[model samples]
Target: MKFRSLLIVAVALVAWTNVPAKSASGVPTYIASAVTDSARPPDDKAQDAKRKPDEVLAFAGIKPGDKVVDLMPGSGYYSRIFGKIVGTTGTVYALQPTEMDKAAPKGLQSLKTFAGTPAYPNVTVLVQSAAAIAIPEQVDMVWTSQNYHDLHDPFMGSPDMARFNRSIFDALKPGGIFLVLDHAAAEGSGLSRTDDLHRIDPAAVKAEITAAGFEFVGESKVLRNAEDKHSLSIYDPSIKGKTDKFIYKFRKPLS
Candidate 1:
C-alpha cells in the first residue's frame, strides 16, 4: 500500500512541474514588450498615424531572430515594428523605392534617421528601384503592404513592374515567405484603375507574383468585407480609411 501511495505522489509531482512550464512556453516571451513598444507612435505620425502595426505584424508572422525585409517601407511604419520583433539578434532591411529620391524630398532622410536611432539599430535602409533592390543575402521573409498595385500601374512603366517582382523573388531564400496586403477590387478585373482607385484585383496580383516563381501558399480574409460594393474607389471619402483588403502569403518552393 505504501509503495503505491509513493508512486502516485511521484507522478503528481512530475505532472505539476511540467504543466506550468508548458503553459509558459506557449506564451510568446516578447509579445508583451513588442505590444507595448508598438503602441508608441512613430516620429513621422503623418505616415503611420492611421496604420495598425500590430495587425500588420501579426499577419506577417514576425518572430524573434527573423531576418525580415520591409519592402517599400514608407516612413518606417512596419519597419519599426519589425525591428522590435526581430530583436537584437535579427536584422531588418528597409527597402525604399529609388523614385522616392526624386519624388519625396524627405523620404531617404527619414529612413536614415529611423535606422540611426537606438530603437531601430538593427535596421538597414536601402534605396533602390523596387524591381531591382540589391541585398547582400536572401532574407527569411519579404513583406509589402499597400504597394503591390504600384507595380502594375502604368505610371511606373511596364518595364519597372517586371523588374520589381523579379527582384522580390530573387531576394527571398528558398522556403522564404512573401506577404502582400493591398486594397481589394472586384473579381475578373485586370489591374484596372490601380493608380486612380488605389486598389488591385486579387486574381491579377496572384497571377503576376506566381509567374515570378512563387508558390501560392494561402490567403487570409481577416480584412475582407462582403459589404464592400467593389465599385467605389478605395480613396472615396466614404471608404477611404476602411476599404476591404486582401492578404496573401506566398512561399518560394523548396526544390
Candidate 2:
C-alpha cells in the first residue's frame, strides 16, 4: 500500500511537470507566479499597486506558450514579466527602437545585458527603427504600455502611423491581440499633448488603430484616475505615476 501511494504521488508529479503553468479553470497559472517572481526588480514590484499587473495580464488574455512582442519595451519592465508568464516553451520579443536607444544608449545596453542573462532565457532583444517597427515573426500578442504616444513624436522618426499600424495588424496571427495602455488626455486633445504633456485622447487612438483593420475587442478602467482633469503633463509632480490612463485591446480577426 505504501508503494501504491508512492506510485500515485509519482504519477501526479509527472502530470504537474507536463502542465507546469496551468490551473484547473483553464487560466494560465504562470501569471500569478510571474508577478511574484524573484527575478523582478524591487522597483518594478513597488509599482504593482498602481500598474495592476495581474489585471492587465488577465485583460490581455495572455497564456502560457504564447509568443508576445513588447513594443518599445522601455526599461524591460513588462518584458521580464511577459517572459515569465510565457514560460520556457514560449518566447518574448522585447523591441527597443533604435531612435530611443540613441536617446539613451545605456538603457538599451542594460536591456540587452539583462535580457541576455539566464533569468530571461526566453526573451530576445529586437532592435529596430522606430518608424519601421517589425516583429521577427507573427506573435500571439503585441503590447505597448505607456509608449504608444511616442509613435506620434517626430523625434521617434515621425512614424507614418497609418502604415505603422498596418504593419502591426499584419504582424499578428489571426485572432491575436494588440494591447495599448497610455496616459489619458482631454477628449478633443487629439495629438496635441503627446510631445509635451505626454498624454493622448483615447478615442483618437481607437479610431486610428481600427482604421488599420484591427477590430476593437475591449477596454479596461483598471488604471483610470478620476481626479485627473486631463490638463496637466503626465510627468507633473502632482500626477506622475498617478495620472489617469486608458487600456485598450484590439484583435486581428481570424477571417
Candidate 3:
C-alpha cells in the first residue's frame, strides 16, 4: 500500500514539474543564442514574443556555416539574428530590392549599418533588382518573411513572378531551401489581397512556387491563428501581430 501511494505521489510530481521555456525546450543552442543575443536591439527583442524567432529559426534549420539570403530584409531583424547564428564561417546577404529603394530610400540603411558593424562581419547588404536578383554565389537558403506579398503590390511594379521565382531558384545551390513566411489571406482570394490586405492565399503561393520548379516540402503551423478571418489588412490593429501566418518550405531540385 505504501509503494502504491509513493508511486501516485511520484507521478503527480512529474506532472506538476514546470515545463521548459521554448528556448530550452528542444530548440537548438545556436538558435536560442541568436534570439537571445545581447547585441539585438531592444525593439527586436520586444517583438520576439509575437515573432517566435526560436521556432522560425528552428524551422529554417539554420546551421553555423549556412549561406543565407534574407530577401527584402527590412530593419535587419532576422538578418541580425542570422549573422550571429551563422557564426564566422557563414555568410548572410541582406538583399534589398532596387524597387524598394525607390519607394523607401532609407529603408535598408539600418541593415547596411548593421552589416558594416564589426559585430556582424559575416553579413553583407546587397541592392539588386527583384526582377533579376543577383547574388555573388549560390546560397544554401533564401528566407523571406512578411514581404512576399509586396512583390505583387503596385509599388513593386509586379514584375514577371515566374521569372522572379526562377531567379530565386537559380540563386540557390542544388537541394537548397526556400523558406517563405507570409500573412495568410482567404482560402481562394489568390493575389487580390496582396496590395491592400498585405496577405496572400497559401494555395496561390504554393502553386506559384511549385510552378517555378520547387518541390513543396511541408509547412509549419507555428504562427497560425484561427481567429484571423482574412478580411482585414495585416496592419490592422485587431490582427496585426496576431494574424494567421504560414511558413512554407520549398526545396530546389537536386537534379
Candidate 4:
C-alpha cells in the first residue's frame, strides 16, 4: 500500500509540472470592473482593444487606497480608469509636463476639464516642468504610457534623464512599482528613433531604470506585435494603433 501511494504522488507532481502557464488574457475581477466602469468616455472604451487596459492594470497591481501618478497623462485615458480602480480612498495624480502644454495647449484641455468634474474627484492634475518632476507625496506606483520617449525629445525640454529617473526612484515608497509602456524601436537603435519614430529600444529603458536603483521585476508581452518591422514612425497610418510596444515593470528596493 505504501509503495502504491508513493507512485501516485510522483505521478501527480509530474502532471502538475506539465500544466501550461496561465494565458495573458486573464483579467482580475477588480481590474475588469474598472475597465468597464460606466463613467469612462465612449471614445476611451473604443480604444480598449488596442490599449489592453485590463491586462496592463492587472500587471501594475494597483489596488484601493494606493496613491498613483499618471506621469505625462496626455488625455487622462488611463487616468480615468485608474481613478475608478483606486476608489475614493486612493488618489491618482495626472502629472503633465508644462512644456507639452506650451507646445500644444488644446491637446490637454479635455483632461484638464475632467480633473475638475465630480466624476473623478480623486483625480488631480499637476502641471510642472519636465526637468523637475514634483510628485507631491511618495506614491505606491508611478506610471507613464507611450510618453517616456517624449522625455528624450526637445518638446519636453530634454530633461536630464539620469536625474529624472532618480527623482522617480525617490518619489516611490520602498518596494513601490514603476511601470513604463512605450513604442519599441529596433534592438540596437538606442535613442536614435525617439525623435522621428517615437519609439525606443527596450534595452535602453531597462538600463536606465536599473541604474536608478530599481529592480527589473518582469514584463508583459500583451502589447508586443511580432509583425512590427521596428522601422516606421509610430504615427504612420499603417502602424498607428498596431505598432510594436513594450511594457516594463520595475520595483524600488525595500531597504
Using all chains and alpha carbons, the TM-scores for the candidates as numbered come to 0.80, 0.88, 0.90, 0.89
Predicted candidate 2 versus true structure: per-residue lDDT over 1-255, tens digit per residue: 999999999999999888746545444577878888998989889999889888788789888899999898888889999999888889999888898888767757767877857999999999999778778889999999998998888778878889999999999999999999999989898998899988889998999999999999989898999999998888789988999989999999999
TM-score for model 1? 0.80
Every model: Cα RMSD to truth: 5.3, 5.8, 7.5, 5.7
lDDT, residue 43, candidate 1: 58
Model 3, residue 222: C-alpha shift (Å): 0.5
> Per-model C-alpha lDDT, please?
0.75, 0.88, 0.91, 0.90
Error of 4 at 12 (Å): 22
- Tell how far residue 136 is off in model 1, in angstroms: 2.1
Tens-digit lDDT track for model 1 on 1-255? 999999999999999875422114243435435655744464534444345445555556678888998887776767777787788889999887776455554756767877948778899988876446787688899998887787666544444555667777788889889999888888887788587787899998898889888998888776777888778887788887677888899898886
Q: Model 4, clash count?
A: 0
How many residue-pair clashes does candidate 3 contain? 0
Residue 7 lDDT (model 2): 100
lDDT of 4 by residue, 1-255 (tens): 999999999999999986534434566566788888898989999999998998888888887788999998888899999898888999999998899888877647878778857989999989889888889999999999999999999888899999999999999999999999999999998998999999999999999999989999999999999999998999899999999999999999999
TM-score of 2: 0.88
Worst 10 residues of 3 by lDDT: 16-25
Tell me model 1's lDDT, rounded to 2 decimals.
0.75
lDDT of 3 by residue, 24-99 (tens): 5688878898888999999999999999999888888888899999999988999999999899999999999999
